[model samples]
Target: MPTVAVPQLSVADLDPATNLDAVTERVAALPDRVDVAVFPEYALTGFVADERACDAALERDGPELDRVRSVAAAHDLAVVAGYLERGAGDDRLYNALAYVAPDSDTTVYRKRHLWAGEADVVTAGDERVVVETPAGSTGLVTCYDLNFVGDSAAFAAERVDALFVAGAWPAAHSENWRLLLRARALDGVRWVVGAGRTGARNVPDAPLTEYAGRSAVVRPDGHVAAALSRGERDLVADLDPAVLAEQREFIPVLEATENDGSTRRNSRPGSRNKNGV
Candidate 1:
């Protein structure tokens, strides 16, 4: 089992220093046995676009993320955090998340699916990012990617054990966020750890909005193993491979559907049976 922590933070008008410091402090406060810590989307830069957005953007090897890497190394755990990345070009930017592992190179996962207005400011990522860890193989996804099940299904096909979702979802559509997290976990049969931002954020050029901070860890059976309420808190839970195996033995959905590349279409309900049956 892998102990994972999702720190729910209120990212309202926080500068880069304060944001990074918040994450560092959170990691410092987490349980020593926690294998991974996932932070909310735009936790470092807040949600800003246009010229101001570019200013908040950071290079992968820049000083900003160097501090984050140090935090991961110090904690001796893998840290996943969202930030604005300065893209290849001067004007380009990416809604990126970096996975920093102790004694390992950081892997950046750009947001492949952009939100409604994000395309104007951020370029969409064309590749999927997954990494191996001592606990298991972990995959990454951003806010809007939850709407697409195929992306998560792809990870399931690749035998990903856990998925980390970093999101800055608004308070209005929080139910959708909850539903998607559970759905992804159930459908993919993998542990889904979701970290979301809270409080009201009034970006310089963007609209003022409040974040929904229902950060949670979902089991493979679509149940929330652990969750934090609408505030600044940490939701830590263990993702047991035994539980996943047991659930898969009961349902066997991911293995059957992905390995065979075909799905059973039963007209009647309760037509399927368990793997051991």
Candidate 2:
């Protein structure tokens, strides 16, 4: 079992320096047994829908993330954080998430399903991202991506043991956020960790956006293991590998999904089984 943390943070808009400081402080305060900490979408730069996004974007190899990598190494834990990415030689910015671990090179996953106003600011990613983590093979997705059932199916076909979702979902539509997270977990028979931004955001062009502060960890059976509401706090829980083993054996959603062309299992040979990874 890997101890995972879902931190609901109120981001500092267009201020990477301040948010990065908070990230460092929060993770540094965690107990040694916590294997990974997942932060909300745009945790570093907050939510940007204006020209300021260009000013706020950070390079994957830049100093901002190098500091995060140093923290990961020093603490012996992994960090999943969301930020606006300045892709190399690419004209547009990307809403990307970085998975930084102690033993592996950093893995970056750009948000594929751009939310309503976000498309005007950043380009959507072209492919899916699934990477190995302390919690086993984990798939990364952003806020709007949770609405697409097919994305969850793809992760299911990949036989991911867990899904770490970084969300900046609005407080108005918070119920949909909770429902989708549970559905995704039920569909894949995998754990779903959703870390959402809390409090209010005031940007240049967009209206004052109030984020749903429900940072939660949903078990394979679609039950919430730990959740937080209405404030900034860390929701920590131990993700038991045995839970995946028991759920997959009971439901076998991935095996049933192989019937359709929309998704098919990628052969990992000995990488996974119905009981465990």
Model 1: pairs clashing at backbone N, Cα or C within 3 Å: none
What's model 1's lDDT at 17? 82
Give the poorly placed runs of model 1, Cα more than 4 Å off: 12-14, 258-277
RMSD of each: 9.1, 4.9
Q: For residues 23-104, write the lDDT of model 1, one tens digit per residue.
A: 9899999999998889999888786655677767777778988898889889899888899888654667889888887753
Q: What is the C-alpha lDDT of each candidate?
A: 0.80, 0.84
Give candidate 2 misplaced runs (Cα > 4 Å). Answer: 259-277
lDDT of 2 by residue, 1-277 (tens): 7999876799999999999999999998888889999999988877668887898999877899889888888888889999999887767799998888875357778888897889998999876777788788888889899999878877887788999999998999999999988989999999999998998898767689899989889999999888899688888899998988999999976786652223222133112224221
Output the worst ten-in-a-row residue range by lDDT, candidate 1: 268-277
**Predicted structure with the largest TM-score when compared to the true one:** 2
